[model samples]
Target: MPSSSGQCTCLRPFLLGSLLMLGFLLLLFTYINPNMDSPSLGMYFRPAPSCSHWANQDNSTLESDNETHHTTVLIWKWPFQYKFDSDCGVFGVQKCYLTDDRSIYNKADGVFFHHLDIHLGDLPKIPRPCFQKWVWTNMESPDNVPRKPWLDDLFNLTCNYRLDANIPVPYGYLVPRNSEDPDFQLPTKDQLVCWIVSNWNRNLLRVQYYNRLKDHLQISSYGKAFGKPLSEEDNKKVVSSCKFYLAFENSVHKDYITEKLFRPMSLGSVPVVLGPPRDSYLRHIPGDSFIHVNDFASPKELADRLHHLSKNPEEYMRYFRWTKESKMTISWFGKEHACRTCGYIQKHRKSIEVLDSTASSQPPHGLLTASSRPPHGLLTASSRPPHGLLTASSRPPHGLLTASSRPPHGALKS
Candidate 1:
């Protein structure tokens, strides 16, 4: 119906108009959605990056100045694995990703290793840079672990994951209604002294001490290390029923307090603690709360004190006084543990520099023993937030007290 020139002229404006509209829309998207890299709007159409992908991306973009923004920690060894979902953020640190592949060790800001599982054959050959922190963690003290001269100088931070560690990963429980409220009535406990030991002869000193203590008084025993197997519930019930529980350590080392102390304290039992100096325990526990074995010259004398307390319920109840304000539960494991490790790194990676000092050299501050508690403190709490009882509510979400949680990485592992 029209000439060829007229037809071409009519189509040119429509094509040009369509292209202009498309160009304008692309420009708008590029401005609003910074993630859209391609000229095609695939970012708008495609799904968001999965956690692993995001972690990979994070590793690629870890600017030296922006250490606070990244959140990936590598578990360098087995026995402990990062168990949380990729999206769960704890204490403000996001879980960008976690991997067992040690090849990507540099990608992570922190590297975690269970001291028990750490071996010379399995160690990473690469020296970790200052930005990368190595966490020296273990449930046992130095005495418990086999001699590894190389391990003495391998960590940027220490986690005494057991109850009395620098990070004090003590167990937690719901505070009792009566304990917290002065008006609520206190419950009466029935049983006498009990010991739930699973290792019979592991610690010769502990074995010798327990044998001597049992000679003076009737000590009910349970667990594989002693009497028999008990379920978690039954064990708790047993401990709760007892008036006193032997919260004895396998080996006596400075601040090597373990669940033995925490379990009894949480279950309303007066813990007859037999590790560390009384003053060291004083740092974590209320002085009046438990009886220290060191307080008495011998196991028999300790037995006599327990005997007197059992007859005197009013006196026995004094041990529960501290429970009103503080509740003791169990240490976290799996993902929760990983979250804590990650959060600790995000907060401290910038400040803490890993030093491979020999045992003879001066060890890091904060990680010093009870001998240093009176005067010398960890590096200096100047860089950290104020510390509190190891409750989620008490600890500052951003940073942890260096003095409280940085016990010497190289210590007896009882």
Candidate 2:
């Protein structure tokens, strides 16, 4: 009813007020929830190894699991007699139970049998139930895993590091979120290149590369090979303080990356890798986070690249940009395996499956093995966390010690 000029004048304050409110909301959202980029699930992380089919049929007792049933996965033998807590909830999965007591094996829905613990003569006494499934659990690489033809029909499922397994467990993973800053303060560096290794086999490709690398640069070496025995504390201090860590694997194969890579990565030291090709690592981590030894034409060229990056802060920080942006997730070893197995059984409970008897029993992929025997004077894990037992088969012997994990007497914790 008013004139055009008068109407426009009155609407000015309302438009200004709306614009101010909208700006405030956008700023609030941007600050509170930073990463608007697409999730890094398939890129950085391997989809968290979820139960592909989903949960189980209805069980009225538990209100949890969305009216679905709970499942019990029994470990036939504790790996290396290194026991872990049976709580599946600790790994963020629900309505799942894990147990090692052989007495209750009859009631369990599924069972896990470790490869190393299975002695041929000593086998399960009881007859297998029609519904009960025996899962073959092995984390050994292709070569080290001894062929067991007898196991062809025994295992209905597998638990290993392979992406295609019923329960896939990689050494570490990256969360799908991004932070404004990773809160990673660089440790004081007293060394340039650090190689903490016990296994010193010249025949191994990694050791051969290390010898060539040392010819080009001065590497501050530690561990049994160098006669400088590092305590658990010093092991970490060395990695954190060094500008770069040589995460050379004792053996090379697909998906054989181990704690040799993870320890330095978690410790804020860039890893000069010699294990799998760069493409294999790119699946688990960002492309620029590590320097693959193969990328360089020669060891001298690789050493030159290291020197150039060391002197240049901008170039070197690219290797650590992921730590500054995303949260890192370490494999809580046995906990993840048990939880995933529990989830897998619940999903496939209605669908009875029998593995083809002709299939090879050797695990396709797993924690890598060193080429030869473990180095001398091996210091076993003095302390062990309840997550899982660390075995030589699952890691490069004394791969690298972690702050919390207590690998078994012969196993290295990372």
Candidate 3:
């Protein structure tokens, strides 16, 4: 109502002041609001709980336990020894010392030949019948051989361990032609038959005839006598290509589940197992994962099953699905930590009362006992120390001590 210029000036200052007040209010609201996102805020100033602190604490505890409970185990070196070795911290028996001399077996040969003896004599605590090797035919005579007593003693000492060493495959090896091809190359049906005819032995024929099978079914062998050894990678590829594999055991013994069964099953191939009763082998593997020769009344019956399975891809694929869905991870050899011998030792360490009378009932003469207070704090939780800390105890807490305490990894020596 006064001058137009005066009114315009009044509105300008008012608008400016209002905008400034609105910005100031917004800043104040942001500072007070707990839910507001502020990128500039320091982590320490934040009100939220620190998950990093908890994680660090957990990791620290694990490290501490690992530092405390380290153990070193001495093992006999052998090429065929598939038992766990503590030094490698891996599963499977590794060949440490190889030798050409047959007269005096090195640690490996000694362990291989006298496995039962050493185990029985309490010199070695490994499980019985540790490998899948053919016993020299000359040594098969049960006559006045010293090995008989050793076997008998081992049997008497530990009925808990299984001693069967069946060869699932009779000098069988796989070789893959090409892997990347959608239609991977496999041995032709005719080629397989021809190979079998050339390589079949009297023993092998006996197995075929005893099983009452067809002569027309395609079968082949990569013979050991011929020395056509398939490389490890080729073996894996062959398994992947094949729908079925023959898992022939070297010997027929009770409760022996060999790699012939394990490898094929692991590679998503259905195994045609030729060892032990179906029930015995199932103890080690998932039921329905394999087809046993004994399951079929005749060779035709077995062949029919195989043919039907091959034609029906859905059913055949089910076997592999079961393996995957179950998340089963099978190892051809036992883990370093899985030595039945070491397992026994760990179990008895706390329960051992006296060294003399408390010796393991099976093999290896050491007796362990559980004490309210173990010597050298071996049995106590304090035996474990922080990681990188020297002078830590070998005994680590196996379980979480409390909400405030946790054990470290690599803490135990096993």
Candidate 4:
């Protein structure tokens, strides 16, 4: 009995010590992270994957006879399924494959997502590779797209119209064109001022501005609002005949300028603009290119200026002078966005690394391709960046992302 008691006494200290050590560890863990309810708390602070952290690897380089490395970008959702050419040929991006095959997710070097299609319920389900990158894009204004909390840290890049985006995709921009070419000529004008609106939103500032501007100016109206919807062909014919077109936009946002300004100028009509400030327009077009409503104290003043310009043929002709120096370039939205996605992935291959987003965030996912967005003008838009955009920063960024507004935001509809 004494021998058994001695053995039991020795075991008590050992067992008690083990229990105390475990209890101490439990207390330390509880102190380290007090809130056990929210697992996302940990994920919220998880460092986004950095380019330097990812060692250079062979990655998804497709081999060819010339040895050019091909980067595969899988589009997870086609924004309205507006696919164009199968590749990035339009953007002159060579060596990049834009595909919609989910089966190839494991092999793709990058995956692109349009904000409109991203439902928290339907995210990528496959295990993320260390080398793959995920891109988030939204081409809509904030007025249209409500912020999704999931947006943080989940994407490696952004593509959009905002200048700060990783890949800046403007609606359209001014570029040098041959004005001396005999084929180009300003159309003969007969009308005073014109406006064509299809999507009418009373809440828009352009609508309110138009209401007041019309009281002072003799303006011709077209499209659904005036119950005279012109076919696209007829619409251009009317705009070309008018001396001025009200290229008013639906929203006043930074870099939200769109085809409202570009189409009128293309049709040889001065665009009486109504979006962004005059300075924002000046960034893309020459100072004398378009008439901004914001420059005048009242609609009456803008009306008086227009009347004066109409009477002064020499002054009116100056508005078309940009034709002699630069041309407008607006791309079809879907294909160009995808092409650029592929090009960006290919170009920044060194920085390509998949985000280690929370495993619980995964949802059943698929792949895709799509398009939309454009550019602007003047007699010659002054020295704006060729595409009214700055490419990805020169720094070796963590990952490249771009944004573009979608349905909630109008490309030009006001």
Q: Who wins the TM-score comparison?
A: 2
Instruction: Report the error of model 1 at residue 204, Å.
Output: 2.2
How many Å off is the CA of 255 in candidate 2? Answer: 1.1
lDDT of each: 0.57, 0.64, 0.36, 0.64
lDDT of model 1, residue 335 = 40
> Per-residue lDDT for 187-269 in model 4, tens only?
98889999988878888888888899889878899998889988657887999999999988776677667777876776689
Model 4: CA > 4 A from native: 1-54, 57-67, 178-183, 352-414
The digit string of per-residue lDDT tens for model 2 on 178-284 reads 34434678788878999987867778887888888899888999998889989878888999999999988766677667777776887889988988789888877
Give stretches of model 1 more than 4 Å off. Answer: 1-68, 80-98, 101-103, 125-130, 161-188, 334-337, 357-414
Q: How many clashes does each candidate structure show, in the order listed?
A: 18, 3, 33, 35
Name the Cα RMSD for model 2. 22.0
Per-residue lDDT of 315 in model 2: 87
Top of the candidates by lDDT: 2
Model 4 steric clash total: 35
Q: Model 1 — which ten-residue stretch has the worst lDDT?
A: 372-381
What tens-digit string does per-residue lDDT give for candidate 3 at 113-209?
2232233343334322111111111011111123322332121111111422111111111222223323322332212111111133456533455
- Of models 2 and 4, which has the larger lDDT? 2
Better of 1 and 3 by TM-score: 1
